[model samples]
Target: AYDGGSPTRSSQMRLDIVILDINDHAPVFNQSRYQALISESLLPGASVLQVYATDADQGPNGDVRYEINRRQSDPEGYFTINAQSGLIQINKPLDYETRKVHELVVQAKDGAEQPEVGTAFVSIQVRDSNDNQPSMTIIFLSEDGAPRVSEGANPGQYVARISVSDP
Candidate 1:
């Protein structure tokens, strides 16, 4: 060996790196818009439907929570949603005569410090129920002013003019 100039040995090694995930993805609903048809007789606290969403990120960033957007027009407070389960339920009585259709905006947000949010539109159509009793108006056609059938009344004869209606 001629001092430091003689030779210099070299060593080579391989290195690997791992990249962790961040809260970069927002929750996405299975459907952007949903529709349901329910009867007006549906009672309070009854389950209406379920909404679902998913996040692509890992850990807490991927966790999704559900909510009914209060910013939307829900003046009747007719519906509620489960924060963790995304189950939509009826919060009040439904009346087809009062309002036949309801529109709601639901939100899904990720569990992040600065959460990302996704929105879905829900349309509920209330089917008419037999909630109202039929009203009747009768006008007697008999010779007597009172509501009575005469003994000599002919068969299939019109006894009274009846009108019925329901709202």
Candidate 2:
């Protein structure tokens, strides 16, 4: 290390050089965007996906904490984050029929005082689950609009209409 731009000539005099870390660099995510698909039948508190980031700063200044921007990004309140781990987890059940896509912003901030921050976008696609039971409606009638059955009836003698729907 040079003191005042001039190196002090010393051998056994013992000159200690220390480099300090400053919060000059902001945390940066490895990727600008991350996407994943999850089933709508997934329960709450399940881990869906994760995002990673890095900071050039040293020591505590490089340590990052993750968070979700609820007001502007996660308005539906469907997700959570591990502050120190950068893991994004689910907070509630998902419904693909009502809504298919969820967009949220993830923020990474350093542990330094007046910490530098960074952000990334996350897109979660909810896949429809075959959990809904089909609803069926049946109507039976004769050609003359009267219900009549015969043991010796010919083929195509009965008229029945069945309709089914599911979500």
Candidate 3:
């Protein structure tokens, strides 16, 4: 029997492969600071300011999610955000007495697991508007010159104390 041996001559094989980049880390914000102002006179629900961010990765890996991180100090959520759009809008009225400036931190995350996180600071300055009227604590002085006045005081009389609060 005759046997044919293999590999007597050298041969070559060709192959093609592509490797995609992994989005291990997300894009981070360079500056995590911001400030803004909205006059109390402005109509309620008015768009005050907008915040923006950037992503370093490509494709869906670069897609980011935006959200507002509320602190314990902020019982009331005074701001809103558009996740896809990265827009921040005011959600409540501001009272100077209660809060003159609002401090907030915005977070951005990429699609990757344990995605990279970025932060931004926002300071909102509230201006005074005629909308807030001051009311006196005392309703009115008695005609008999009595220190204590009875209930049902006149409109102009000192009825209650008025204060302003902002968020």
Candidate 4:
């Protein structure tokens, strides 16, 4: 036991680590609030409208999945969404008298282990279709004033008839 004891030294080392961003995220629908006008009397297989979105991620991770979350808004599933194309179509005709614009929320998330989510809003404007006929409402004119004539009328017509079109 005549040998001297050895001393130990303490030092610190640096390490380099990098985290690559993945495009595993699904495409997020910017239009969370979407409004589409579907004709109640539309022919089957008619194209209603198309939806759009973008993803922050790239590659397969960026590949998005689309679905209509109208579980609450449309209990019977009146709409359809294209997963790969992001197109929204009408599965069934929509009655403007019953419902004019549909309100829905679309969600987008990354495919990463810890995913990220984003959202957007949309407003769909439905145009009227000449499906429903307009009911005539005759009004007796008083001596106060004459019927308001249209400046761009067809020679003899008084004014444009008030006929609410359908969608």
lDDT per residue as tens, model 4, 25-73: 5566655556665556775466666667777776555655665556444
Candidate 4 lDDT trough over 10 residues, lowest sum: 158-167
For model 4, the superposed segments whose C-alpha errors exceed 4 Å read 1-38, 113-115, 133-167
State which candidate has the highest lDDT: 1
Candidate maximizing TM-score: 2
Off by over 4 Å in 3: 1-15, 71-75, 135-167
- The per-prediction tally of clashing pairs is 0, 0, 8, 17
- Cα-lDDT of candidate 3: 0.69
lDDT (Cα, tens digit) per residue for candidate 2, span 1-167: 33454456434457699999999999999999999999998898899888999999999999988999887787778998898887888898888988899999999999898999899999999999998889998776766755667678889875777789997
TM-score of each: 0.76, 0.77, 0.67, 0.52
- Overlapping backbone residue pairs in candidate 2 total 0
How much lDDT does candidate 1 score? Answer: 0.91
Better of 1 and 3 by lDDT: 1
Q: Model 2 — TM-score against the truth?
A: 0.77
lDDT score, residue 50, model 1? Answer: 98
Which runs in model 2 stand beyond 4 Å of their true positions? 1-13, 138-161
What is the C-alpha lDDT profile of model 3 across 43-63, one tens digit per residue?
556776666667877766788
**Better model by TM-score: candidate 2 vs candidate 3:** 2
- With a 3 Å backbone cut-off (N, CA, C), the pairs that clash in candidate 1 are none
Candidate 2 residue-wise lDDT at 141: 73
